[model samples]
Target: MWHSPSRRRREAGAANMTRAGRTQDQRWVATAEGEHLRGRRKRDTKPEVTLRKAVHRLGLRFRLQRKVAPRCTADFVLPRHRVAVFVDGCFWHGCPDHSPEEFRGPNAALWEEKIETNRERDRRNTTQAAEAGWIVVRIWECEIRRNVEEAAQRVAETTGSNEAPRRRRPAMPK
Candidate 1:
């Protein structure tokens, strides 16, 4: 196929037009919403770390960001007690208490759908983990920030049971 000079130039320019006018390579688009989304941390988040530290100080050590079942990697995984902890952000998770103005910005529908999907996924994951004999501990971000000690206490109470800590696998010979 013979390519005209104008056709080549047109094609070169098309490469720069990204989806939703987003920058190439997913770089920051220099918008408030864009910056907000980019700032979302997966692990080692402040709330997650605070809760982890609080729980640790209470002598309830657990694995961080480990999968106890398929498609469900908890923020804190207590294999001994078969517990999976998830620290959820209010805004991202669509907390009703959050200010409505937060979701009133550009692409509001997209944000609502995203948050709804997150809620549904959380429900499904909780059920799946329960069926697999694991307890799910969900702490709201505000709750963790407001009272980390209370969250730690909840974890302790949930895992502190008459049943001994059950090992997931047999101990290897040392």
Candidate 2:
């Protein structure tokens, strides 16, 4: 069964640790509880809400979590413009600028494998979308949090054009 950090800390008497006599057991318990809380908080973040509001205010029409061609479900899809936007979470997507060393702690091998797989999957998806002639825009959660307007403007630049040129496939060989 999963326990909340507050409950776990209380059960472990985390608040009563003396500065000089802090036992290894108490330290481990506190660290574990802190990591668990951080993971949960990251999962419940509201970056998508802010992005949606900003894009809407810019008068952009887009579909959320919509499926595009070849097994791609983009975070935001502008079908008319053939643009797909992805709002990547820093922790999950392993943001180069913000991913903490803690993510690579404990089960280092397992985390490396998992995060690498996620990165590869993102690359494959982006490549496939581009091959299908869709403009792909990737926005990191941290970037949106830092500046919603800037993130929205980046998205708008990709999809805001009134006339998107049609993509022509190569001519068939004889």
Candidate 3:
């Protein structure tokens, strides 16, 4: 079967448009000649990198993007702690407050459906991990950006096995 150039271009344009409105940069459009290209990182974003670095600085070791099971991968996994951290992109993961009213451009319906599917998958993964005795933590990109240290601290506290010491009551004033 043969496809016309206009149709192919339209399809490609639609695909590109799907990610257009989000704050992410599109560097691959200039390189790819076809509609479908594999192995390209959609949002190998900087916030995630910064968060990872911060976690590392806190002396935390983790597995990056480890596959949990069929059709799911945890963004960061601490096997010993049974903790999984997911650095969710505000746009792609449908952050209730941060996601745009509509996706990058005109293909809002498609993007909405795609994002909803991602959310459903995330829910399923969380459920599966919980069933397997893992603590799942999801941090939005915006949250990390707003207060990376706090977010890191939460992750550390959640993943750390050490029990927090109880506070003693102050002695009665004389």
Candidate 4:
């Protein structure tokens, strides 16, 4: 039978799809929304930027994406005081405020399992870091975005020497 090039291409593409659908361990289904969600970054998110800027303004400097343990890396690490900060995203980290089913879409069960796994991993990492004498500060995304200064202050207090954080002043131009 005669066929157009576009039609033939579509036919060939459709043949590659699995009739059985996704496997058990599949991360996301083949969809545009799934691809977009999968592309999210683990570090340097908007909340992280806001918190970092606030902390810097408070005269505090820390390492970004620093490795606290062999398996886990923290969002911010203060080597001097052994403090590790993690800014958890509501959707990805399974925050109680948001419903995972909404974000999960078609993969509701899979997404719930994934979120639970994430929370468990976070808990394990926190415990391990604490046991290693490292202070783990887990700040929620909403809290950081709502008041960056307050978040910075919390970090400073946790990592500081019990004194007020000194704000840095820019040098006057000659």
Off by over 4 Å in 4: 1-25, 99-104, 162-174
Model 2 Cα lDDT, one tens digit per residue, 103-151:
5445555565666787898899999989888999998999998999999
Clash pairs, candidate 2, are none
Q: State the displacement of the C-alpha of residue 151, model 4, in Å, after optimal TM-score superposition.
A: 1.1
Residue-by-residue lDDT tens digits, candidate 3, 7-103: 6657566444333432213332232431343343544467778888887767777888876656667887878788888888887788999987765
Q: What are the RMSD figures for all models against the true structure? A: 6.9, 13.2, 11.6, 7.4
Weakest 10 consecutive residues, lDDT, candidate 4?
Answer: 16-25
lDDT, candidate 1, 1-174, per-residue tens: 988655665666756545454435444333676777776788899999999888877677699888767998888887888989998888777666762544565566666677789889888888888888898999998898778899988988889764443455878899
lDDT leaderboard ranking: 4, 1, 2, 3
Leading candidate by TM-score: 4
Question: lDDT winner among the candidates?
Answer: 4
Clashes of 3: 1
Candidate 2 ranges beyond 4 A from true positions: 1-45, 101-105, 160-174
In angstroms, the error of model 2 at 60 is 0.4
lDDT of 4 by residue, 42-114 (tens): 7899999899999888777799998888698999988888999999998888778764545535767777777
State the C-alpha lDDT per candidate: 0.78, 0.75, 0.73, 0.81
